[model samples]
Target: MGIVINQSIKNTVITYIGFAIGAVNSLYMYPHFLGEDFYGITTYILSSANVLFPLMAFGIHNTLIKFFSEYKTEKEKKQFLGFVLLLPLLIILPIFAISILGYDSIASFLSRKNAIVYDYVWQIPIIALCMGYFEIFYAWVKVHMQSVYGNFLKEIGLRILISIFLLSVYFQIITVEQFITATMFAYLISMLLMLFYANKVKPISFRFKIPNNAKAILVYSSFIILSGSVANMLLDIDKTMLNQYIEIKNLSYYSVAIFIATVIAVPSRSMHQITYPITAKLMIENKYDELNDLYKKSSITLQIVGGLVLVGILVNINQVYHLLPKNYSGGILVVFLIGISKYFDLILGNNNAIIFNSKYYRAILFLGLLLAFFAITLNMIFIPKYGINGAAIATLISITLYSIAKLLFVVLKMKLYPFTVNNIYALLIGLLCFFGFYYWEFPFHPIINIILKSILITLLYVFLSFKANLSEDINSVIIKTLKIIRMN
Candidate 1:
């Protein structure tokens, strides 16, 4: 719990830093310098690369996190780490070779009548490899319980570099092609930084030794790779499918909307990084009661925070779209649906971590993969007609089904759930707060209106939350925050 708290604080700080930089880049710099087409190109390239990363890494990153603690000695850990490091090459090298060999066919298949993706297709494998090693090294650090630094580097450092790259384009120092190339360099630099941090935390030894658990590690990694691929597809298939069915320009609009909406899940993402190792440790020790408490508390806290973010987005979405180009305003509903889906994920708390760490984890992920397939199929069916909104609908339905399936599995198979009466109170208070703020228009400027509305909504939410005791944990946090601010 202490680690969760500390890491959550660190993650919150870094997330804001990333968001601040991202705000400047996305809101001002991207539109001002890159134009919407180039901006969309940038986003599409990264999303495409991310979708390929799981395949490149072959799931060894997740497998390492799950099994690293099982090793008893430094020598054993080093050998395990070495094996993990080497394992990706077996997949990435062949994939890269094939990509180069099949570049023409792949390009022809992907290039629609309106879209010309050939210029950027080559960068995908490079970005994938860089991202793959970054995750692998980051997991190396996570297994050592030094995740905060890695997360800061990942969440803040990478965005900061990208911001700088965008600024270069803004200053007329680089063409769109140069900016695209520089983007690959930024990822490489980020990966190198991860390696440097990994070395600083625990020097990587190149020793390889055969261990009894190596077979289990390989098997787990294989399944994890499949799971990671499915999860990545769940997140990115919409963008990819949209490219196939709609005009390329829509991808930029959808990407921006989705990015803003996904920010609501920041707290959940932050908590998951810390919770994963903790959940693994708990399961190792057979601490079901503490794990259950963690699950419930995390769900409520995440829901509270995520709900606030969702409310802010929903209430001020008009203002937000006004900040963007008029063309992107069409994505408002997309934002709403995706935002809700991400919040639903937040309400699940550490359900994913629990499932991944538990003995039944593989089966759970297999079920999730099946759900993800259905999601992709739905998107494929719907996006051609509904466009971005259809993508959002697919996401909403898939994520809802996925979360429910996970909950049911936890309840029936594990006999565990992450809900209580307080969750109901929190949900009710959140709805009231959203509704209360939704209709109340402030007599101020758009920015000021947003600020005032957010402050008032937060106040009402907090007041009712405390009155209802929706979360004892959050109540304590509010008290402590107030006390600290008062002292200041």
Candidate 2:
């Protein structure tokens, strides 16, 4: 538990730092330097890469984490890791071959909606392939319980480099075309760095031996590829589909709002790195009581922190949009809709880890595929009418449904629930702070108004959280924080 909380704290800080860097890139550098159309292209290419990478990786990243513990013997572990490492090549080569063979028609099919995309469409697979290897190495570190360095690379390194490139564009050091190409390859650099880090953490067992259970593992990896693709699709497909239906510039606007909203999910993302393998180990050992305890604690702690972020975003949304260019202001509703859906997911802590690592993981393929289809269908119906806002609505509906199904499956089938009585109190706090401060204003600059409102809201929320003792884990941290500050 100590390591879990400690590492989670470290990763949370690292993730927020990354988000802060991303905030600058999205809100200022990209808009001010790249302009809306170019920023739209930037977002489109990256989002496309993200959506495609899962299939290219063939879910070996997930397979590595799920099956790592099953092999207790050193030799089995080495062979298993060896097998996982090489499995993605089987998928990647075929996809690359197909893309090259059908390059003309494929480019034409995608470009008809927005011709700008055609020029850079080829970057998607390259970036996605890089990302696929990056995730594989990242999982390699995760099973070793060393996710901080990987998290830093993931959350901070990439964004910081992007910031530098955006500045290069601002200074006329490079053309937009060169900048885009450089940006796509930056991920390749990051992935290579992780390969070194993984090897350093534990020198790779480069043995080419196949494990005895190779067939079973390959089947699982296939299920995981579909599962992983659908998961990424749920997160990323809306932006790609938008390219098919609207002017590309709208994606830049949508990307900004989604960026602001995604900050709420950082805690879950950070905590999951360490907790995932822990959950897997517990399930393997049949430690149901301890697993349930971890589940509830994680849910409350994440929701408490995530709820605070959500409220802060909601209250300050007006000012945030004001800070952005006028053209980017239309997706305020996108922020809220996406934020709410992520919150529901945040409350279901470790639910995904539990399900993906359990025997019922195959069931996820069916459910995830259904939701992915539903999301794309809803986008098809909604984007023609609603544009970016419609995409958000489509996402909101699809993700909410997807999350609800996962939560129910975990509870009904596994009999493990993450909600606590304090869950209601935490929600009430967020809602009260949101409504109370959202309408309040100051006769000052927007920055000053944001600072003042945020301080007041945070203070009131923290005071109430402490006084009410909403979570023992959080309360303990608060106590320790105060003691450290006062030198007690």
Pick the lDDT winner: 2
Writing each residue's lDDT as its tens digit, candidate 1 over 46-105 gives 888888999888787778778877878998888888877888877888998888999988
Give the alpha carbon lDDT tens digit for every residue of 1-488 in model 2. Answer: 78898999999999999999999998999989988888999888899999999888888888888888888877787778887888888988998898899898898998898888888888899999999999988998999999999999999999988988988998999988888998987898899999999999977787788788899888988988888888899999999999999999999999999999999999999999999989988998899999999999999899889998899888889988888889988999999999999999999988989988889999877999999999999999999999999999999999999999999998999999899889899999989999999999888888898889989998999899888888888888888999999995
The whole-model C-alpha lDDT of candidate 1 against the native structure comes to 0.83
The list of candidate 1 runs beyond 4 A from truth reads none
The number of the candidate with the highest TM-score is: 2
- Locate the minimum summed-lDDT window of 10 residues in model 1: 110-119
Give the Å shift of residue 57 in candidate 1: 2.0
Q: Which pairs of residues have clashing backbones in candidate 1?
A: none
- C-alpha RMSD values across all candidates: 1.5, 1.1
